[model samples]
Target: MKTIQYIAAVLCSLVLSGCSDFSDSINTDPTRPGVASGTQLIANAALYLPGLSSSPKGEFMAQYLAETQYVGTSLYPQESTSFYSWYEEPLMNLQAAIDSDDLDAGEGPIANQIAVARILKAYFFWNVTDRWGDIPYTEALQGSDNFTPVYDSQESIYNSLFEELKAAVATVVEGDIDNDIIYGGDMSKWQKLGNTVRLLMALRLSEVAPARGKEEFNDALNDGVFSSNEDNLVFRHLPEANNQNYWYGQIVNQNREWWALTETLVDEMKPVNDPRLPVYGNPARESDEYVGLEFGEEENIGTEEYSLLGSDIYAQDAPVYLVTYAQVRFAMAEAAERGWIGGDAATYYNQAVEASVEQWTGSTEEVADFLTQPGIAFEPGNAMKMIGTQRWVHLYMFGYEAWAEWRRTGYPDNLVEPNGVPVPGRLSYPDNEVFNNADNYEEAVQRQFGGDDDIHGKVWWDQ
Candidate 1:
């Protein structure tokens, strides 16, 4: 943490002074100009990756972690979540970098920097489109020139993303870049990350458009992807107040025990003797065993009685895994079962489980024993269920991604809260969109949901 912070500080100082001596750049600047240097723009854009992965709303939606106190989100409250901040900040910064010629050659090759920006931009857009279905894509981040940008279909957005990711991977040069908080400007890892994201996105179309899914999946597989846990794309938080883990702030700094593991997670893991259970959360205070509270339990809700997040998870400097080898392996396993790729589904399944266990537990000592359990064992007929369930568990605090997968696969078909509200298929468009971009918003809602804009409306891929 100290080394990373020191490097960042030095890089920021150098960039602010208009020097090309350092290899990295600043953490984040909300007031940063759209015309900033390529390095500065990329650095600022990268800052939001951690927050994206560890979103509390996503956690609640996935029912992995529940609110111990307020409990509103756990009950599946209907709300208009905004993507404006995403576009206004990171997405814009990434766009600036992608368009800029102000390259800091000292940081990395200009090609690599642009590639990184493009990849991050695609990822940010991916998150937005997944959450809200159709979104302002083609005209987004155009600044004041396009406040009322038309919403692009989710299908189009995904197609554009695949192209962007492919181009980004191909654009990489043989040079390590700095100012990259993720991967430390490791170009090979960046290439793999891009391909991995493409692979997963391709797989999302398995049900809706399997031909495209198979072609893209194999294209990504052939290009290259994460082969080991060391290649995981992670955002390492600092111990400083400005960059501490979000969970740490909620649980430790604020002295508020607001989030706890849900019964949905605890029941699945505990009964199967899942090795990741201990690493996922702590044992309940009252039970002295791992106990997850019922999702959306408004009455008799005590923070200590239910398992809170594991200590390491909420630690100030904990690293959030953005994309991982385990995720790619699971995608491979699923593709195999779908016959989109030629390989034994069980091989990839076992490897995915082993990779996930090694990733969370930091050892494979118990993986063999854990895999022998009935629920954990890989049976070809039951492959999809096993793969989907394990993928959900492996996703952990990556709530939105898990929620998206759940919607796609209908896996763990028991995501209902105590109030009888099942997980929402999608978040409604932001209120700002309804008011400010009413015409386009209405058109999108009408096109996608037959004029409803409701939470239960399916995204393009989910359909």
Candidate 2:
């Protein structure tokens, strides 16, 4: 009986081992690869880009909108903010697609995919570096091989971004791209966006590196930037609740009355009869006219008295602009004013203001009247201020870009801070960096701003 039992156990063990081997053999099919395609990777990366521009903190910092309830972010406080998502998600996925075996073997033409990824990666890095002065660029996103990446100077990062943009625009090849939400795999649009982004980056260096800025700006303009409203780089949000516009999610679904139009913004627009004011905000609850609350007065102000975000902004399917023709035209106007380009500054300025009005109102009638206003007209000596202020108004919902521009140009200069606190210049490094990447964080602070992570410390470009 014992011998028989032993034989049965041995047989059962052998059968289980055979099944395990069979399962392992059938787990992978050679015809169906498990790796994500370049197209899919790019689509995923594109989804993350719009969120950077959606943060309400940016609007608060730029003084476009004031907080009604929690005003912590509006009044500058030393808080750590992490930008690891830029590296961990889209950038990592893009790198994987670039390194895929199918791409290298020419299963599909990889040039276009590579170009798009490079351009987007450059954009993400540019956003990150602009917010926080220096960041991990050269040695970043290398998993397991390099855990602690050194921070690269903002200057070096910008230089590398310029090269990446140039190569990306120049390397477009004939290929079919899938899952592209921005331009539906249109290489021409992607090329234009790349050049447009290059133009923006070049303009950032106007004060710090004027010669290089002029050279790159001209190169990008020649390569072709955004030409019209059709060429704007925008992300169209879905109607679904999970994928609705950020403002929709905040104002409608969340049932929160946190944001109100700022007095600074309303005062500027009301005097000039800016047509975009109605499009930008609804009338105040107490009165039929548009009214805004002062920044950092949440404790004193009631939510129902001030105007909330416009109904158009709460629509689920609203499009978020990554880059707009209005912005491009304004950049051109500034470039011409600074003698970086040959066109007349006034022409570009008028075109920019008109484009901005038409972009919201879908007509040119209101623009002509607005331009005739005293301060609205383009003055050669005050070209920079005029362009900067109009750009601020044009970039209404695009908070991050607006804040960056405000810091750089100092237009709309009289931003009233609560409690006599000055506006923040840069966000501090995330707390995780202090605990995890301590040495690198300390070194970055020491080298960049003499060992203090103060919000008032200006970035290299801002100087």
Off-target runs (Cα >4 Å) in candidate 2 are: 1-33, 104-108
Question: Judged by lDDT against the true structure, how good is candidate 1?
Answer: 0.84
Model 1, position 418: C-alpha lDDT score? 58
Which 10-residue window of candidate 1 scores lowest in summed lDDT?
13-22
Off by over 4 Å in 1: 1-35
For residues 98-212, write the lDDT of model 1, one tens digit per residue.
7766677887899999999899899889988989999999988777688899999999999999999999999888898766777766899989989999999998998899999
TM-score of each: 0.93, 0.91
Model 1 lDDT, residue 212, Cα? 98
Candidate 2: tens digits of C-alpha lDDT, residues 250-348: 888888878889999999888888889988899888887788899988567777788878887768877787789999999999999899999998999
